[model samples]
Target: MILIIAKALVKDESLELFKREALELVKNSRGEDGCIEYSVYEDQEKSSVMTFVEKWEDRAAIEKHEGTEFFKEKIGRLISYSENIEITLNSEVL
Candidate 1:
């Protein structure tokens, strides 16, 4: 299994729109093949800070998701709303 963590510092003016798009992204991604889990979170003290946590069967599953039209579109939009972003991948310990 693999875990993906995407953290972003969103622009203040784009907060609402970012949440809307991210919600749809999470919902759609959850239904994809090999999607073990997908969720989004916000920092209570810093609303502009957002995170996306995803669990997949493997790297191939993540690649498949990245190739999806909605994924491409939404991710592009999300990135546009962010001041900065960081992404990391992890492998589950056996």
Candidate 2:
């Protein structure tokens, strides 16, 4: 299994635009074959931060997702509007 946590810290003024782009991507991503789970989350204390939490069957699943046009375009737009963004990947310890 593969787990990914992608976080974007949007500028205060760009939050709405980020939300629109992100939600669209989320809706599409959920239907993918290897997508166990995909969703957007917001920081409770920091309203400007948006997080995408994803679970996939394996690395191939994630790579397929990254290759999609929708993911590329949406992520590019989000990155442009964000102050900072980072992704973390994890695998089961056992």
Candidate maximizing TM-score: 1
Encode model 1's per-residue lDDT on 1-94: one tens digit a residue: 9999999999999999999999999999999999999999999999999999999998899999999999999999999999999999999788
- Supply the TM-score for candidate 2: 0.96
Per-model TM-score versus the true fold: 0.97, 0.96
Q: Please, what are the lDDT tens digits per residue for candidate 2 over residues 27-71?
A: 999999899999999999998999999999999999999999988
What does the lDDT come to for candidate 2? 0.93
lDDT of each: 0.97, 0.93
Model 1, residue 67: what's the lDDT? Answer: 100
RMSD to true structure for each model, in Å:
0.6, 0.8
The residue pairs in collision within model 2 are: none
